[model samples]
Every structure is written in structure tokens, then in C-alpha cells.
Target chain A: MPVQLAIALTHLLSRKRQTLVSLTGIVLGVAFFLAVSSLMRGSEGDFIKRLIDNSPHITVSDEYRQAQRQPASERWPTGAVELRRVKPLTEVRGIRGHPRALAYIESLPGLRAAPVLVGSVVLTFAGRIEGVTLNGIVPDKMKQVSTIEDKMIEGSLEQLAANPNGIVIGAGLARKFGLAMGSVVNAASPGGEVRTLKVVGIFRTGNANYDDMQTFALLKRAQGLLDRPNRINRIVIQLSDPYAAREVASIIERGIGYKAVSWLEASEDLMSVLLVRNLIMYSVVSAILVVAAFGIYNTVSTIVMEKIHDIAILKSMGFHARDIRLIFLTEGVILGLIGSLFGLTLGLGLMALLARVELKPPGATELVFLPIYWGYEQYLLAAGFAMASAIGAAWLPARKAGRVQPVVILRGMG
Target chain B: MNPAGREGSPPMLTAERLGRVLPGEVPVTLVQDISLTIDRGEFVAIMGPSGSGKSSLLYLLGLLDTPTAGRILLDGRDTSGYGEDELATTRLRQLGFVFQFHFLLAEFSALDNVLLPMRRLGALDEGSAQRRAGALLAQLGLDGQAHKRPHQLSGGQRQRVAIARALANDPPIILADEPTGNLDSHAAANVRQILRDLTRELGKTVIAVTHDLTFASAADRQIGIVDGRIDPHWRA
Candidate 1:
């Protein structure tokens, strides 16, 4: 071993109590840092997974991001053209030239798209009226784009293919209306069209509001009741990689002149809020490491103070200033290395403990374990910050030890 | 104005108008315009009263402190322009120091203390360094006390361990500041004889500061200092 490292080891070994105290501080700091960060990031990942799973990756709605330019504005670019008393044209609320658009969308690889006609309606059962959203879908196409088939408690979406006037309603609404599968309820559209549809399917999505206020039916039957034929107002899309939604949505919007919004774009505010929460979490945890570094500084400074005589003798024996500095700095590095090793092990144990904790959330039928995200970056970050703090704390006292002049100390010794 | 170490066989150490000043509010001059010479294998003693700057002159010659106004030379090379690292290197290879007290590291054994300089100089392997440290301790009559810490040894044994440490790197010149100042009469006499033997038998130049008349009388020559200046008429 180098003489400096040997000196450092002797110094630490001679003062075992103070050295262990400093090491304990670092270990606890790193362990707590990793534990809290892993838990927080784990929950965030779980929430994002649920968000991506339930919602369509992209929704191409029958609307433009901007209104169509006037004929005069289109003809003369950048010209100050103003027309007075111009009224906007009214059109049917459905995507125009939708067949060509659907064919174009289906050409893309690793994507599934389905047409949906959604509108508001009122349901009356035994003179009890409740407003709800009505979604019209083709059974086979809807199966590729949605997970409603898996959520069904009674019958599947394919049953609606056989029954022309079938409707699927949530368990919440069925309970409120005192109805069961095969029961008939009167649904009235805004255009004065009414029909008695048979409830062919019942589903429970575990969200009370969605379970109570949403129903699904066949596209042709819905068109006949609502008086809009051969029109689809939206295309719900699922992708193999949901994170690629933004790029796909933008491409579709540019191609078809509709508003195509990705789940990422729809939940942009929630993403930013999550980012700010992570920043706050890291700052709080890093503060613990900084505090632990102070303990190292105190221990090293005391060692320097106690060894002033030894330092003087070594300097008189022709040890360079930098060699003395290296000895102390080596002490800090040893502490950081050993501390981080134990802390990482403790943090992993904590994560394992957390992963086994089971809880039943309200309205959930089964127990769910706490999510523990096993990301490698958190380990790297924790160790990196600890070493930085340890080295930074050691620098000041090492410099002080190096600047000790042997002559003055020798004079005082006499 | 004559520089030390310029005579026959080229004195192991030399000083040229050596001076040291404590720069502070009062600006004290510790040593002033001192020029001296001692040939190889000569044992010289510097005698002075309290606060007479004898230790200051010794530190200047040992390269432990930089002279404010003059230069020193070891083995005929001027050291005025050398940086701190070079000066330290020269001190490690050419000069050894013994302080008034036995400055052995308290945590180290007597053997380890003797090995400290050899380890720092890295001139030999660990096994060789250990053997050399054991030999130095045995020669100093500390044969069985090599593994004892400083606190376990007597005052005289500790001083002998310090002398063994100083000689570990085998430097040619040994500079001691009151080598026996902290010991009793018996220990003092033993330390004095050991230093005298270093110059006479081993051909090592020895310069020591002392208030003991017997220690000064044993030297080849004795110089006296008063108020930071050499007293020309004083002799022993």
C-alpha cells in the first residue's frame, strides 16, 4: 500500500468509535434516500401504466385545430384581406370522407383503429330518468381498440353483433335502474328518436362515475335512432408502443385535417406535475446526504486537530504537503465506499419489504401489493451523490492539514 | 562571511549569512547574518541562553524553515532557489533532525517509528526496511523494546528511538536541537555519548544546540550566540 493510505488506515483504526459514527451517518442517509426515491418512482410508474392501459393511445376527433382559411386569404398569402359580415358554414357533426381516412390509418403498422359515434342520451326506467353517454361501436373493430370485452361481467361485445338492438351498461347503472341482462330500457336521443334496447352485457370498470354514466350499442342501430347515417365522429386507436402516440397522432392530424390528440398530449399537465414532484423528492433526499457529509467533516477535523504533533513531525521528516492532504482524503473515500455498499443492501431490503405489503383500496375487490420500481438509475444516482458529498466535505480539512508549517509547531513544542 | 562546509573533504553541511525573521506586528529577527563552517566528521555544539535563537539557526540549517535573507548549501549546492518540494527532497536524502523532545509517533511502535522515514523514502523493500529498523533499534541498545509504543518506553529509550528514526534514511548530517534537554542526568549522559559516537565512529557530521556544559565540552568546537548574533570572544 502507499504510505498515505497506510497512514489513513492507521488513523481510522485507532479511532474506531468516531469512524463508525461517521460511517453510520452515511449509511442511514443513503439507505433512506434510496428507499424513499424507489417508492415514489414506483407509484408514479404504476399510475402511468394505469393511465396508458385504460385510455386509447390516440383519438382522431372530427374537428380542425384551426378554422378553414377564407378563399381570399388562401389566394393572397400575407395580404391584409378582410371581409365584412361573413358567417361560418354549419355542417353535420361527423368526419367527412371518413372511409378514405380509415383506410389510410389502417395502413400504418402496429396500430389498431376503430370508428366510434358518441353522443349524449337520456335513459328512462319505470319513470326514472338519468342522462348518460351513448357510444356506438362495431363489435369486432371495438374489440381490437378497447379492453371492455375483458371488463364484461355478463356478456361480451360479440353478443351485440347478433342482437341488433342490444346495449351494454355498467353495473352501477344496472343497480340504480334495478335491471339485469336481457332487460329492456327506453333510450331517447336529442333528435326525438326513441328505442327500447335490450341490455345484452353488464360491465364493472371499478370507476364509479364511468360505471354509472356510460353505455355502448351497435353502430347501425345507433345511427337509425339518432338519425345520422354512415358517419363516425371519432377513431379510437391502440398502438404497440403507447409512448409513440404523439408522433403518430401528429402525422394523422396533418394527413386528415382533424384534431388527433395523443394520451401524452391529453395528460400533459399531469406529466408536468409529476416532474415537479420528482424534483422536490430528490432535493429533499439529497439534503440528508449533505447533512451526513457534515459528520464526516467533523470527524476528520477533530483527527487533524489531535494529530497536530504527528503532522509536524512528519513534515519535519520531509513529507510533502500534498502527501498529508492525500492521507486525509483517502479516509473520506474509504468511508464513502463502505457506507454506500451497506446502504445499497439495506435499501434493497426495504424495497423487498415494501413490495410484499398488501392492501385493499376502497371499492377494490382484491388485495394489491405496493409497487416497487426496480430502476438501476436510482442506485447510480444515490451512490454518485454520496461520493460527491463525502469528497466535498473532506476537501477543506485536508487543505488545512497541508498548510500546517512545521517550524512554527516545532517552536511551540519547545 | 565564510560559508560552512567549504574546507577539506567538503563539509557535509554549510550556511551562508543564514537569517530568519518572524514577520508580525513587532517584526522580530530571530537570527542575523550568521556565517559558519564545520568539516566532515566534526561534532559542533551551539551554546546559548534562553531565547538566544540557537534553535532558529539550527532550523535554518536543517531546511525545516526558509531563511529570510540568506541561503544554505548541502554538499556544496546552493539551496536558495529550491521550491518547497525540492527542499523537502534534499532534507529527506541529506539531513536528519532530532528535536528537544522525543517526537516519536505515539500510536506507532518503536520499530515502526524507525521505519517511518525509510518507508517514506522508499529506498528498500518492506522486508529490508524491517530488517534495517530492527538493526537500528538493536544498535541503540533498544533490542527487546522494538515493538513497544512510545508511551511504554522510558524517556531515554524514547529519545534513543527518535535517534534511530533520524538515522533510518542514513542521511550524512544529523541536526539535533537540545537532544538531551528533556532527560535526567543519566539519560542525558547516555544520549550525549551516542551523538558523540555518531560523529567519531560513523563519520557523520553532528550539530547540536545545548545548555549542558558537559555536552558542549565534548564537542570538537563550541560557538555561543546572544541576541541573534554570534559572540566572537566566547569559547568552551
Candidate 2:
């Protein structure tokens, strides 16, 4: 062993109680840092996964993001006359030539697109009336882009294909109307069109608002009832790799002349909230390590004070100031290394224990386990922070030890 | 002329009007305008009353403390311009020290204590350094006590361990400050004889500060100090 390190070990071993106290502080600090960060990251991952799974990766709607330019403005180039509140030209509200658009969108690799004609309708059953959104879908194309099939409780989406007048209602809606499979209800559109449709399927999506207000029917039937034949206002798209939604959405918008909204763009506010939450969490956890560093500072400072005479002797024996400093610094680093090793093991155990804990949230149908992220980056981050804090704490006392003058100490001894 | 002294060769150590002052509200002078030279392989002693700057002058000569003025030359090399690291390196490779107290590190065993300077110098490998430390302890009649801590050893044994440590790097000059001041007569006599033998057998230049007249008499020459200056008429 090097003389400096050996000396450092001896110094630490000489003060067993203080050394152990400081070491315990570091160990607990690192352990809590890992455990808390893993839980936070895990829950964040879970929340994002649910969000991506439940919504379309990209939704290409039949609307322009910006107002269309007037013919006068286009012809004048830089017209001195600025137009304000100019009335927009009125047209039928739907994607023109949607079949051509759908074909173009489907030509892209790794994605599936489906057209949806959504309209609000009032359903009357016996003496009760409830307003809900009716989505027209082709079962074969919709299944590729929607998770509604997975949410089915009674009948299947394929059954809607077999019965042209069939409709799929949410469990909340079915319960409210006292309707079951094969029960008929009057669905009336604002265009003075009314149809009696039989419920062929029931779904529960775990969201009360969505379950109460959403229903699906065949494309041809919805078109006839709403009086908007051969028209689709929204093109819902799903990609194999959801993270590529932003790029794909932009490409679709550029090609189809419609506003494309990716799930990431729609949830930007929530992502920022998550970022702020992460910042707060790191600051709180890093404060623990900083407090642990104070323990190291205290231990090393005490050792320097107690070993003043020994320092004088070593200095006179031809040990340099740097050598003396190195001894104390080595002590801090040794403590940090050992503490981090134990802390990682303890943190992993804590995560495992947390992962096994079950909780049933309010109104939840089943128990869910606490999420625990087992990423290697968090381990590296915890240990690196620990080492940095230890080194910073040791530096001041090490410098003081190095500046000890043999003459002053020896004079005092005499 | 002292028989063991090399009369014609250049002096091993030279002090040119060395001065040291403690700067404060009231400046105190520990050593001032002191000039001296000791020949190679000479056993010299500086005898004086308490607080006469004997230890201060020794510290300056050993390169443990820098002088406020003047210069020190070891083997014809002037050390006035040397920095802290350079001085420490020079001390490690060239000079050794024994204080009034044993000053052995309490946590280290006697053998480890002796190995400190040799390890710092790094002139010898670990095996060689260990063997040399053991040999030095054995030569000083401390072979059996080499593994004992300072607190576990007797006063005399601890001083012997200090002496063994001073010779660990085989430096040419050894400086002692009241080496036997805390020892009983028998132990003092033992330490005195060992220091005298260093000049006679190993051709080492040994300078010691002492108040013991008998100890001073054993040296080839005695330099007396009164109030931080050389005093010819002083008698201890």
C-alpha cells in the first residue's frame, strides 16, 4: 500500500465512532436518493405509456392550421392595404377527396390510418334523453388504429359489420339507458334524420367521462343518418414506433394539406409539468447528499485537529504538504466508495420491496403494484453525486492539514 | 583537530548570517544573524540556557523552517531559493531529525514508523526498505520492540525508534534536539554513546543541541549560545 493511503486508513480507524457515523450518513443518503428517484421515474414512465396507448399517435384533421390567403393578397404580393376580419369563404366541413388522402397516407411505411366521421347525437330511450358523440368507423380499418376493440365488455366490433344498424355503446351509457345487447333506441341528428339502432357491443374504458359519452357505428349507417355521405373530418393514425409520431405527423400534414396533431404535441403541457417535477425531486434528493457531506467534513476536520503534532513530525520527516493533504482526501474517498457500494444494494432491496406493495386507488377495479424503475443511469448518478460530495467536503480540511508549519507546532510543543 | 573530522574537504553545512523573526504586533526574533560551519563527519554540540534559540537554529539548518534572511548551503549548494516542495525533497534525501520528544506516530508500529522516510524518498523498493528498517532497529538494540506502538514502548525504546527512523533514508547529516532530555541517566548515556558512534563508525555529521554538560563534552566541539547569539564566555 502507498504510505499516504495507509496513513489515511490508520487515521480513520483510530476514530471508529466518528468514522462510522459519517459513513452511515452517506449510506442512507445514497439509498434514499436511489429509491425515490426510481419510483418517480417509474411512475412517470407508466403515465406516459398509458397516454400513448390510449390515444392516436397522430390525428390528421380536415382543417388548416393557418387561415387561407385571399385571392387579392396573393395577387398583390406586398399590398399596402392590410385586411382585417375579412369573411372566410364557406364550404362543406369535411376533407375533400378523402379517399385519395387516405390512400396517400397508407402508402407510408410502419403506420396505419383510418377515417372517422364524428357527430353529436341525442339518443331517446323510453322517456330519457342523453346527448353523446357518435363515431362512424369501418371495423376492419378502425381496429388497426384504435384500442376500442380491447375495451369491449359484451359484444365485439366485428358484430357491427354483420349488422348494419348495430352500434357499440359505453358501459356507462348502457347502464344509464337500461339498454343491453339487441335493445333498440332512437338516435336523432340535428339534420332532422332519425334512426332506431340496436346496441351490438358494450365497452368500459376506465374513464367515466369517456365511458358515458362515446358510441361507435358503421360508416355507411352514420353517413346516412347525419346526411354527410362520403365525407370524413378526421384521419386517426397509429405508428409502430410511437416516438416517431411528431415526424410522421409533419410529413402527413405537408402531403395532405391538413393540420396533423401528434400525441406528444397535444400533451406538451403535461410533459413540462413532469420536467418541473423531476427538477424538484433531484434538488430534494441531492440535498441529502450535501448534508451527508457535512458529516465527512466534521470527521476529517476533527482528525486534522487531533493529529496536529503528528503532522508536525511527518512534515519534519520530509513529507510534503501535498502528501499530507492526499492522506486525508483518501480517507473521505474511501468512506464514499464503501458507503455507495452498500447503499446501492440497500436501494435495490428497497425498490424490490416497493414493487411488491399493492394498492387499490379510489374507484379502481383492480389492485396495482407500485412502479420501480431499474435503470442503470440512476445508480451511476447516485454514486457519482456521493463521490463528488465527499471530495468537496474533504478538501477544506485537507488544505488546512497541508499548511501546518513544523516550526510553529514544535515551538508550541516545547 | 578532531581525529574523525576531514580537515581539508569542504564543510558539509554552512549558515551565512541566518535570521528568523516571528512577525506580529510585537515582532519576536527566534534566531538572528547566526553564522557557522561544521566540517564533514564531525560531532558538534550547541549548548545554551533555555529559550536561547538552540532548537530554532537547528530547525533552520535542517531545512524544516525557512530563514527570514540569509542563506543555508548543504554540500556547496545554496538553498535560499528553494521552494517548499524543493526543501522537503532535500530534507527527505539528505538530512534526518530527532526531537526532544520521541515524536513517533502513535497509530503506527515502530517498524512502520521507521519505514516512513524511506518510503517517502522511494530510493529503495519495498522489500529493501523493510529490510533496512529492520536492520537499523536491530542495530539500535530495538529488534524485539519493532512491532510495538509508541504508547506500548518505554521512553528509552521510543527514542531509539526515533533514531532508527532518522537513519531510514541513510542521510549524511543527523540533527538532534535534546535527544536525551526526557530519558533517565542510564538511557541518556546509552543514547549519547549511540550518537557518538554514528560519527566514528559511519562517518556521519551529527549536530545536537543539549544542556547536559557531559553530553556536550562527548562532542568534538561545543558552540555556546546566549540570547540567540554565539557567546564565548557562556558556561553551562
Candidate 3:
């Protein structure tokens, strides 16, 4: 072994109690850092997964991002043509030539698009009335772009194809109206058209508000009741890779000349909240390691003080200042390495314990295990930060040891 | 006893008007205007009262401390331009030191203590260095105590281990600062004889600082210092 490292080991071994205490500090710090970070990151990942799974990756609405230019302004270049208080053209309220837009959207790779007509309607049955959102859908196309099929408790979306006037109501709506799978209800649109629709499907989405106020029916039947034909106001898109939503949404908006909002864009405020939460979590955990580094500084500094005479002897025997410095630095490094190894093992154990814990959230029906992310980067980060702290703690005492003057020490002895 | 060097060869160590001062608001002079030379294979003693700067002069000569006013020449080479690292290397390869105290690292065994300089110099492989440390310990009559730490050994044995360490790198000059100050009479005599034999039998230069007149009498020449200057009247 090198002389410096050998001396470092000897110094640490001689102070067993102090060394062990400092080592334990590092171990606990690292273990806690890993466990807490894993939980935070795991929950964040789970939340994002649920968000992406339940909503459309992109929603292309039949609206322009900017107001349309008048034809006079388009025709005259550099002409003095400022127009004020000129009434805008009133046009139809739905996407024009939506079939062509749908075709263009479906041509893109890795996505499925379905056109939807949505309007508010009043349902009446047995001297009871309730207002609900009515969504007009092509059942075959809708299944490809929606998760409503997964939430079905009674009939399937395919039943709407079999029964032309069928509508799917939420479980809350069914309970409120005392309706069965084959019950009939009168749905009246704001445009004064009415139709009697049968309840063919009931779904429970675990969201009380959505379950109470949303209903779906076939596109033909909804158009007949709502008095609007061949119109769709929204195109919902699902992507194979949800993370590509922002890019795909922009491309769709450019192609269809409408406003497309990606799920990421729509939930940007929540994303920022998650980012700030992570920053706070990492800083809080890193503070533990920083506190542990102080333990190392104390231990190493004591060793340097106790070994002052030995330092004088070594210097007089021609050991360089850097060699003296290296001895103490080596002590810190050894402590860091050993502590990280044990800490990581203990952290894995903690993560395993956390992953096995089962708890039911408030208002939740089922028990869920705590999520723990076992990513390799967190391990690397923990170990790297620990080593840096150890080295940093050792630097000051090592430098002091190297600067010892042998003549002064020997004269003092005399 | 040759006060001047041998006729054909340069002196092993030379100091020309060497001076050292501790800087402060009121500066203190530890050593001043000192000039000396010692030949190869000579035994010399520097005798002085307390605070007379003999240890400070020894430190300057060993290159353990820099001289503030004048230069030191080791084997005819001017060392004025050497940096701290160069000085340390020069000391490692060319000079050895033994102090008033044993100063052996308490955690290391006697053999390991002797091996420190050889390992730092890296002039020998590990096997050769270990063998040489063992040989030096045995030569100093410390064969049985080679594996003992300083705290486990007697005072005389610890000093002998320190002497062995001084000879570890086989430097031409060995500087001793009160090498036998802490020993009993018998141990002091034994250490004195061993230092004498180093010059006579092994052809090594040995310079020692001592207050013991009996110990100083063993050397061929004695240089006395009063108030940091050489005093010709105060001799052994």
C-alpha cells in the first residue's frame, strides 16, 4: 500500500468511536435521501400517467387562433385601409368540411382522431328534469380515440350502433332518474328539436361531477335532435406516444387551420407545480448530506490536531506537503465509499418496505401500495453527492496538516 | 581531526553567512552570520546554551527550513534557487535527521517507521525497501523490537529505532538534535558510541548538537555558539 493511505487508515482505526459516528451520519443521510426522492418521483410519474391515460392527447377545436382578415385588406397591399366598427361576418358555428380535416389528421403517423359534436341538453322523464352535456359521437370512430369504453358498467359503445336512438348515461344520472338499461327519456336541445332516446349504456368514471352531468349518443340521432347536420365542433386525438402531444398538436393545427391544444399545454400550471415540488424535495434531501459532511470535518480535524507531532517528523524525513495532504484526504474518501455502499443497501430495503405498504386514500374504495421509483440515476446521484461532500470536508484539515513546520515543533520539544 | 575538508574533495555541507529571523512587529533573530563546513566521514558536535539557535541552524542546514539571508550548498551545489518541493526532495535523498525526542509515529511499528523515508524516496522497490529497513534495525541492535510500536518500546530502544530511520535512505550526512537528551546514562553512552562508530566504521558524516560535555567529547571537533554566533573560547 502507499504510505499516505496506510497512515490514513491507521489514523481512522485509532479513533474508532468518532469514525463510526461520522460514518453512521453519512449512511443515514444517504439512505433517507434515496427513499424520499424515490417516493416523490414515483408519485409524480403515477399522476402524469393517469392524466395522460384519461384525457385526449390533443384537442383540435373549430376556432381560429387569430381573427380572419377582411378581403379588402388582403387585396390591397400598402393601401390606407384602416376599417373600424365594421361588423364581422356571421358564419356557421361548426367546422366547415370537417370530413376533409379528419382525413388530413388521420394521415399523420401514430395518432387516431374522432370528430365530436357537443351541446347542452335537457332530459325529462317521469315528471323530472335535469340539464346535462350531450356529446354526439360516431361510435366506431369514437372507440378508437376515447377511454369511455373502459369505464362501461352495463352496455358497450357498440350497442349504440345496434340501436340508432341509444344514449349512454353516467351512473349518477341513472340513479337520479331511476332509469334502467332500456328506459326511454326525452332529450330537448336549445334549438327546440326533441327526440326520445333509450339508455343503452351506463358508465362510472370515479369522478362524481363528470358521472353526474355527461351523456353520449350516436352522431345521427344527436344531429336530428339538435337540428344541426354534418357538423362537428371538436376533434379529439389520441397518440401512441403521449409525450409527443405538443409537437403533434402544433402540426395538426397547421394542417387543419384550427386551434389545437396538447394535454401538456392544457395542464402547464400543474406541470410547473410538480417541477417546483421536485426542486424543493431535492434541496431538502441534499441538506441532510451537507449536515453529514460536517461530521466528517470534525473527525478529520481532530485527527490532524492529534497527529501534529507525527506530521513534523514526517516532514523532517522529507515527505512533501502534498503527500501529507493526501493522507487525510484519503481518510475522507474511504469513509465516503464505505458509507455509500451500506447506505444504498439500506435505502433499497427502505424502498422495498415502502412499496409494500397499503393505504386507502380518503374517499377511495381500494387500497393502493405506495409507489417507489427504482431508477439507476437516483443511486448515482446519491453516491456522487456523498463523495463530493466527504472530499470537501477533508480539504481544510489536510491543508493545515501539510503546512506544519518541523523546526518549530522540534524546537518546542527542546 | 580534519577541520578543513580532505585535500582533493569538496566538503559535504557548506553554509556561507547563513541567517534566519522570525518576522514580526519586532523581529527576532534565531541564527545570524553563521559560516561552516564539514568534510565527508567526519564527526562534529555543536554545543550551546538554551535558546542559542543550534537547533535552528541544524534545521537550516538540513533544508527543513529556508535560510533568510544566506545560501546553503549541498555537495558544492548552490541551493538558493530551490523551491519548497525541491528542498524536500533534496532532503529526502541527501540528508537525515534525529531529534531530541524519538518522534517515531506512534501507530507504526519500528520497522515501518524506518521504512518511511525509503518509501517516500521510491529509490528502492518495496521488497528491497523492507529488507533494508529490517537490516538497519538489526544493525542498530533493535532486531527484537522491530515489530513493536514506539509506546511499547523502552526509551533507549525508541531512540535507536529513530537512528535506524535516519540511516534508512543512506544519506551522506546525519544531523542529530540532542539525540541522547532523554536517555539514561548507560543509554546515552551507548548512543554516543554508535554515533562515533558511524563516522569511523561506516564512513558517514555525523553532526550532533549536545549539552552533555561527555557526549560532546566523543566527536573529533566541537563548535560552540553563544548568542547565535560561534564562540571559539567555549569548546569541549
Candidate 4:
């Protein structure tokens, strides 16, 4: 088969003009196949990875307990206390009166819980005031579920342990407000009292949107500032396996009698965009390959007519119609294989080139870095698609060639 | 009749009432009710003016067409009963043909061109087929020219390559339509002498279509056709 393929390619090569056109058609089909598929799939990968990082591992806040509901122990002597993560949708969970909620969750198969206090507040420094989400977390508990520790640019978790007034400011907010390590910023609670803290660390979490808005501090400091002493809005659960996000959320919802939210529940819009982008990319790229299929049909059919005399001579000389058909089909396969190899190289080259290219924001300063997003599985899938298209395009013409009557053609020529 | 009158009844190719209707706005019957028999190891010439069914008869005899009427017989078996596939098999194993233009695949070398039929039939692998093609070409006085393409060779060399192709399968009979029509007198005479010697030496039957009297005279038998029918009784 290799020898036959080599001979067929040699014959095609002898007619250089025709060979060039056919080869170009094949290469274009394959290259297009790889390019769009990679971009779309890469975008999906980037989005999913970001979504996983942006939210808690799993959250079971309130089904009906209201945004600021407090545990009975933490409630005022006669009045209900107000403390909740972001505003609760509704209801309380199994953690009521369970101070060992974190230990209890950790003991449950595959579940680990971290107590987090999410409080939105106003930050005032030098005369400028900006709204912020103050996420109060224990350092070790935060590391279990968040990529935060991995992203810190300066200052150690020990520094966080050392200073009771220690806090971390996001790089985006720090740049915006002229704040730095050791600088003082006054944080005001939603209820209007002010507390000042010295910045101990600054974290640059590559995600532009989230980095601009988040701040971190010790849970006790957040509790005092928010006037929710000994009360937390949510116990965010972490799991060993990332896929357990949905399953554990479901388990918490069913077993704890509260609404458990996965990342998808939180960022439905983002997930929707991911799905639509994949759909559009596949649709548009496949339409392009379909157009390329026509090129293949035209090329193979033209080559068939050009090689008619050769075909006739072979038929008259005792070549079976089937072997002749197989030759053309195999020719299509060879064209596809060659085109795929070339496309794989070209696609990889494009991806490599794109990776180094720095896409700066329009009208923005040089501080932001946007790394190119991609992975390698994209090339193999694209090659498979291109080969399938080539074979599909060549099928009809090959069948047409197989059915040509040698006697009719020979008689006509004579 | 007792066609060849040869031992073991050397297989004969017999065409009976064969006709071909050529396609156009309206059908044109190129040949009608043509019947003839040529035996193994005989050198026969069929001569006629243009449009006289000489080439048409060769095609029918070669099983390159389904006759409009009647039957073609090879080794006393009815060929009309054979399907296209069976007919092709019969052509590969028993029938050979040479055309006036010597339709060598222009891209292939002389030896490769000769080996084409056997290769198509898968009768031999590449190595054995090449050796057989080499032997046939050497026999046809095309030793070193075997490596040359048809365009790279002369008119004589190309015709010799076509002749080698006809004999590649060692078929029982050869059907040639104007075997010398495209050659110069020197090449035509050489081709004619080669056909005569082929019967005497290789003992291969050859049925040639030609109008040249000198070429016709070299054959063991001569038959003339005019207006699509053979006139064996007409002698010029």
C-alpha cells in the first residue's frame, strides 16, 4: 500500500500544477480545522479553570435563613443577630449549633469545609472611598480550597499570623488607590463603623476582573468590623477531587436542607457563553470545511478526467474496476494524511507564535499581561476532522470513476 | 468448421452476427452482423477502407463491447453469457489487442507499459512482472529502450512497446486494429515482418487490421471488408 501510495503521489507530482492546487486545497482544509477548534476549545478550558477558581469549592449558605441570619448561640440576648455571606437566598443548613461544622464536613467522606466570612464594605483611604468584598479566612483553611496562597506576590502567611491588624490588598486595587505594604486603609462596615488595617501583602491573581475587587483579612477582624462576632455567613466546603463540586453541593443541598451552590449556579452567564462560543466555532469551522470539501471534489474529479486516458488504458489492460476505485479512494486518504501532518505542524506553529504574542489592552498602561491560552489535544481532534472531510469529499468522485465504461470510452476515443 | 484443423483443437475466437450502435443524437450502426473466426498461431489480415468496420470488428472480437446481436465464442464457450467481470477475465487470460496509435501510457517507461496488463491482472508481483516485461521488450528489439518513455522513444520503438504489451499475458490470440497505420514505411515494413516472424517463430496467432497490401500479403490469410461486411470472395 505504501508503494502504491508513493507511486500515485509520484504520478501526481509529475503534473506539478495540478498537484499544487490539490495539495493547497487539502492543506487549507486541515489548517482551518485545527485553528478554530483549538481556539474554541482553549477558550472553554480557560473559562472552566477560571470558574473553578473564582468561587468556593461548594457553598451551602441559606435556603431561607435570610442574608444576615445568626446562629442561636450568636444571637443577641433577645434579638436575632444579622450576619450572612453576600445576602442569603433562603434557609439554614445542618451547621446550626454545630461549632465543629468544619470537622464534621472533613469527616464526611470526600468533604472538607472551611469557614469563610464574606462581607462587603467601603474602604476609605486618603479621601477616596471604594466599595469592596472583604473575604475573611483562616490562612490554612483558605489554602485548602483557594488558589490564593499560590498567587501572593509578597509577604508570607506568617506575616499574616504575626500582625493582628494584617490584611492583603489586591494588586489592581493597590495600583488604583496608591496603597502598598505597610500603608493604612480604613475599612468601614455596612453599618457605618470604621476600622483601620495595615496592608501586609498584595496578591496579583492573573484574572483582571476578580483581582480588582477582592480584599482579605483575619476572620476575627472581619467579625468585629461587620458587628457579627462569633457568626459566619457560610461554611465553604472543599473536596479532594474537583469534580466533587457538583456532587458534594448536591449532597449538601439534600442532606443539610439548604440550597447548595456550585460554580455553575453562581456564574450561569459565563457557562452559557462558553457553550455558545463552542457552538459557534464548530458551526463556522465545519461550514468552512464543507466549502473545502467542494474544492476536494473539484480537484479529484478534474484529476480523474485528466487521468482518463491512463484510466482507460489500465481498464483495457485488465485492471478491475474495483482496484481502480480503490486507487482513487486511497489517493484521497493519502491527500488527507499528508494534509493533516502539515496542518498539525502549522497549527502548532501558530499556537506557539500566539503564545509569545503580548496582547495589550487598548489605551491601558504596560502593567497588564495577557498570556495566550491553549493546550495540545486540539491538534489531534482537528486532524481527525480534516481527514474525515477529505475522505467525504473524495467519495463521490471515486465512485464516478469506478463506474466509467471502458468500452464506451475507448470506442468514443477511436 | 473445423477452424484451425490443429491438434488439441487450438482455441479459436469466433464472432457471429455482432453489431455495434454508436451513440449520437440518433444512433448510427457502425457495424452489423459481422462474423469471423481466427485460430491460434495464424497470421491473419483484415483490410478495408475507412468506416468499413475493420476496427469495430477487432473491438467486438476482443470482447470490448456487448454485441447488439448474436454471440462471440472463445474456446467454444459462449461469451455473450459472460458478465462484464467474466468478460474482462477472459480478455486478460486469452485475448490481447494492439491499436493503431499504440496507446502506450505516455508517462510510463516502455518496460513498465508492457508490464501494465499483467500488473492489472495481478498475474505476477512487481519483480517477476518486471522480468517478464524485460524479456518481452528484449524480444521485440527494445532492450535498453525499455527504460524510455513513449515520448522519449521513436515511432518504431513505441509500436514495439505496444506489441510487447499485447504479448505480456501470453494470450491465445491478438487483435490489432491497423498495426502499421501510424508507422513510416521502414517501421511499417519492420512491424509487418515482425508479425510474420511472430507466427513462424513464437507460434502466436495475430489478427491485424490494415489496408496496406504489402502488410496484408505477409499474413497467412487475407480477408477484405467494405461497407461493414467481409467480402472474402472479393480480391483486388
Top-scoring candidate (DockQ): 2
Model 4 lDDT per residue over A1-414, tens place: 233343466556677776566667667766766666765666566557766775676786745333443455365668755555656456422236436555556667876677777788899889999999997777777777777877788774446667878888788888888998899999999878788888998887766656678988888888788877776677787666767777777766656555678766777788787789788887877776677667667777776787776677666766667756776777677777887788677766766665555655543333432343456666666777777887888788778877777776776666
Comparing 1 with 2 on DockQ, the higher-scoring candidate is 2
Per-candidate clashes come to 1, 0, 0, 9
Q: Which 10-residue window in model 4 chain A sums to the lowest lDDT? A: A363-372
**What DockQ, between 0 and 1, does each candidate earn?**
0.67, 0.83, 0.75, 0.40
Q: Write the per-residue lDDT of candidate 1 for residues A1-414, one digit (tens) a residue.
A: 777888888898899999999989889888888998998999899878878877789999988999988899999989999899988786567998888999889999889999988888899998899999999999999999888888899987898999989999998999999989989999999999999999999998776777899999999888777777898898999999999999999999988899999999999999999999999999999999999999889888888999988888998898889988998888888888787888888889988999999987666544778888889999988888888888888888889998899998999998
lDDT of each: 0.89, 0.91, 0.90, 0.75
Candidate 2: regions farther than 4 A off: A80-90, A123-129, A171-186, A361-365, B1-9
Query: What is candidate 1's lDDT per residue for B87-164, written digit by digit as tens?
Result: 788878878889889899888899999998888999999999999999999999999999999999999999999999
Q: What does fnat come to for each candidate?
A: 0.52, 0.81, 0.71, 0.33
The sequence of per-residue lDDT tens digits that candidate 2 reaches over residues A49-120 is 878887899998878999877788798979776778988777668888999999999999999999999898
- Candidate 2 yields a Cα-based lDDT of 0.91
TM-score winner: 2
Model 3 accuracy (lDDT, Cα): 0.90
**Between candidates 2 and 3, which one is better according to TM-score?**
2
lDDT of 4 by residue, B1-236 (tens): 22254877635777788777777899877678778777767888888887887777777878877777768888778888888678778878887778778888777788878877777667688899889999998988888998898999989888889988988998878778788888999999988887787777777778988888899998888878777788877574
Compose the digit string of candidate 3's lDDT tens values, residues B141-221. Answer: 987888998999988889999999999999988999999999999999989998998888877889899999999999988
TM-score of 4: 0.87
RMSD of 3: 2.7
lDDT ranking, high to low: 2, 3, 1, 4
